[model samples]
Target: MSQPPLVEMIGIEKHFGGVRAVDHVSLDLFPGEVVGVLGHNGAGKSCLMRILAGAMIPNAGEIRVNGSPVSFADPNDAREAGIETIYQTLALADHLDAPSNLFLGRELKTRLGNLDDARMLAESRKVLARLNPNFKNLQDPVSSLSGGQRQVIAIARAIYFDTRVLIMDEPTAALGPSETAMVANLIRQLQSEGIGILLVSHDMHDVFDLCDRVVVMNKGRLVGAHRIDEVTKDDVLSLIVKGELPADWTARNLEAAQ
Candidate 1:
């Protein structure tokens, strides 16, 4: 049998007024795995992810981190537990440089409580160098950086802080192919270092190329999850829209068996 997941959710439910944003969703994420959460508009993907990141509290559920049950009171509470989310908007300060953005709220301080500029810069460079050696000039304003570079800085910040589980919502939604490829490579690097990633994406290509497993959510409910090797994009999309498995998936399975 496979090892237990690094993160597990049991009976997760979240409500906004009378509408159930997330309905009895259960998920497991293993270390060094990328699990894609794919759904169309209004499919509750963000709601479920926010709950996992503790930006939004669940009305009912049990969360397990490293096999120990836990509850989070706030986003900071989740951060303390190594859950980091990079939202679509990126949540980065445009006026700040890469190092500044990396250490924005969690700035390093000297023993006397002054900013430790050297330490933060060194850490930022080290993280970037590990992910992208071509990255240069951490002092440039993020607004002046290319879209892909900005994404790199945001992701570098998350990974550098030792966040075990990174939730990236539509990380490549607004980028060109080359930029997307860069972000995709960075993702692989992070996963190779044993990070668990929950990726929410509308792009089938991104999901297919980067995810080890695909989870489909439709109408606030999980339709199915299949290992990438077990199914095709068409099969997962059918489940996303119709809440039904592709008619040929069983036939495909049978052919593979023979």
Candidate 2:
């Protein structure tokens, strides 16, 4: 028998006053899967991810986590459901150090409710060392770190927290090639630990290289979903532009898109 999906979004719909921002789109994300959602600026891909992250409420449709229905009132609701998002801006406080940023708004505390300084620093150090070996001194101000270093801190914060489902929005946008590559490596590490990932990116290479599956959106509707092993980069691009599968989708993908 097939495994139950970690997340299932059925007939998800959202509107902005008179405009429909997300149409009847549905998606199933498997455990330990890296699923990419891609499309043009107005395709509603971000809207969908925002909804999945519980940043917005869909006008219609059902969202399921481990097959149980969910109503996400906000991002915190999604986080409680094991979903965490790293926005394009990353939302890190540049003035804070790595450990401070990691524990922002959710600090570790002792039984007496005193801030657990020793435990938080030691634990953050451990997780950071594993992912970015060069990282040291979690107390240094983030302004002193490189772009990739800051991104690493953001990703590490999500992973350190028990985030089972990670949502990354345009993670490498406007970064240098080296910075982007660093983010890619971080993603691979997250997947190795069986975290389900939803990656929203503008780079095709990032999508093709990092994701197990691709879900395309266009003009507020789902165009197609392509398994990375069964489709080409060009075919995924076609779906992004044309709002449908390319003529050459594998038989299985064609059936799935239909």
Candidate 3:
């Protein structure tokens, strides 16, 4: 906890027309830590993360990577700063093979200026193996893969580029229990590799299970943040629905009241 945060968004603000999508929200992410961002459908969580991901420019605020202030004009700039986002859509090219999808834009080229299919396949194999050892259908198009496999491909694309801070939006949204477990294991592996992750999910189980700390947002404002061990699920739910933590929620306060 003494180490400086890997990424910091300070006094972030965004507005669309007359509505404020985000209002002076600040958040920090440290290395090898998973921080969950929870909010309702229109609570501005996605908008906040989009600003971090460089998909949307904030009307006001500053972003710092590794304590250095940086500006992202687009997603490429964020990627260059070691930031990557995997949205709920996954964004894989359905017709492309796993290797192709992995190296979709930033393809590895041979010395002769040809597409490096061999190397791409090998690299894909390595990264995919690290994420999912059971995965084997590299030649098949991503559209043919299972939900979990597709999720793996999306994640593989993100981490393959030495991603330092990952923004995952609804990572386990539509997966079966087994597939959800697979993604959870992958998240743990990423954490072990010292990646800072911002997990935006509505699933309480995913938040509690995968996050080291959880922050709640409501009506375009931050409600509060707490260590996962310091609060119960109902406590977080209260924050989500009520836009604030319950009075006497903390252990110390509860003991005092008792």
Candidate 4:
């Protein structure tokens, strides 16, 4: 039999008082695959990803990693389970350089109780080489780096820690076209490395280009999931806006399958 997906969020629900921020949403991410979560501003995409990342507890649901049931007490628990999240902010200290940001809270220490700068720098370079070969600003503060360069540092941090599942929230947001392309390339590289990625984005182009499958959410519910090749941008737009499959989309899919 084939191996189970890298991670599964089953029947997830979250509520804030009377508001149902997420309602019975389910998502699965497989190894080496990128799944795009597309939705509007209040479509509950962020809430679902937050639950999976252990940033918030769900009102009702279960999370399975590699076919084993797991409950995360907090984000730290998620990290311990090989789950890493890179938000829009990139979560890097602006004053720090690439190596410093890469090893931020989890810095390496020498036997004499000192920072192992040489080892950290070498390891950072090794990982960055795989993600962004042109990245060579080792001592420049992250604030000095361009948008794409900063993204590289964030991704390098996640990958260097042996992340198995990565959740990227609007990674290309606020980036120029070229910078967006750079980040896209890094995401593709991560997918090739066999890491499962849950990409939450408002950009339809990024969704269709980078994701193997597109999952749509609307009004706190899962609208539908379509393979990248199975649906058009307009079809996805209809789902996002209407909270239902586009007219004739089901017919088209059935016809194609037959």
Per-candidate TM-score against the hidden true structure: 0.91, 0.88, 0.92, 0.90
Q: Rank the candidates by lDDT, best first.
A: 3, 4, 1, 2
lDDT of candidate 2 over 1-258, digit per residue (tens) = 187788899999999998889999999887789999999998998899989988899999999999899999987789889988888777789888888888887899999999887888998899888767888867988989887778778877777877888999998985788778878887888788878899998899889899999998999998888778767777777888887766655655565677
Q: Which candidate number would show the highest lDDT if scored against the true structure?
A: 3
Write model 1 residue lDDT over 68-178, tens digit each, in one string.
Answer: 998988787788889998888888899988898998878999999999989999999998887678889889889998877787787787777768999999988877887
Model 1, global lDDT: 0.87
Clashes of each: 0, 0, 0, 0
Stretch of 10 with least lDDT, candidate 3:
248-257
Ranked by lDDT, the better of candidates 1 and 2 is 1
Please identify model 4 stretches exceeding 4 Å from their true place. Answer: 251-258
Which tens-of-lDDT digit does each residue in 11-64 have in candidate 4?
Answer: 999999999999998889899999999999989998888888888999999999
Model 4: weakest 10-residue lDDT segment is 246-255
The runs of at least 3 residues in candidate 3 whose Cα sits more than 4 Å from the true structure, single-residue gaps closed, are 251-258
**lDDT of each prediction vs. the true structure?**
0.87, 0.86, 0.92, 0.88
Error of 3 at 204 (Å): 1.1
Runs of candidate 1 with Cα error greater than 4 angstroms are none
Scored against the true structure, residue 126 in model 2 reaches a CA lDDT of 93
Which one wins by TM-score: 1 or 2?
A: 1
Error of 4 at 163 (Å): 1.9
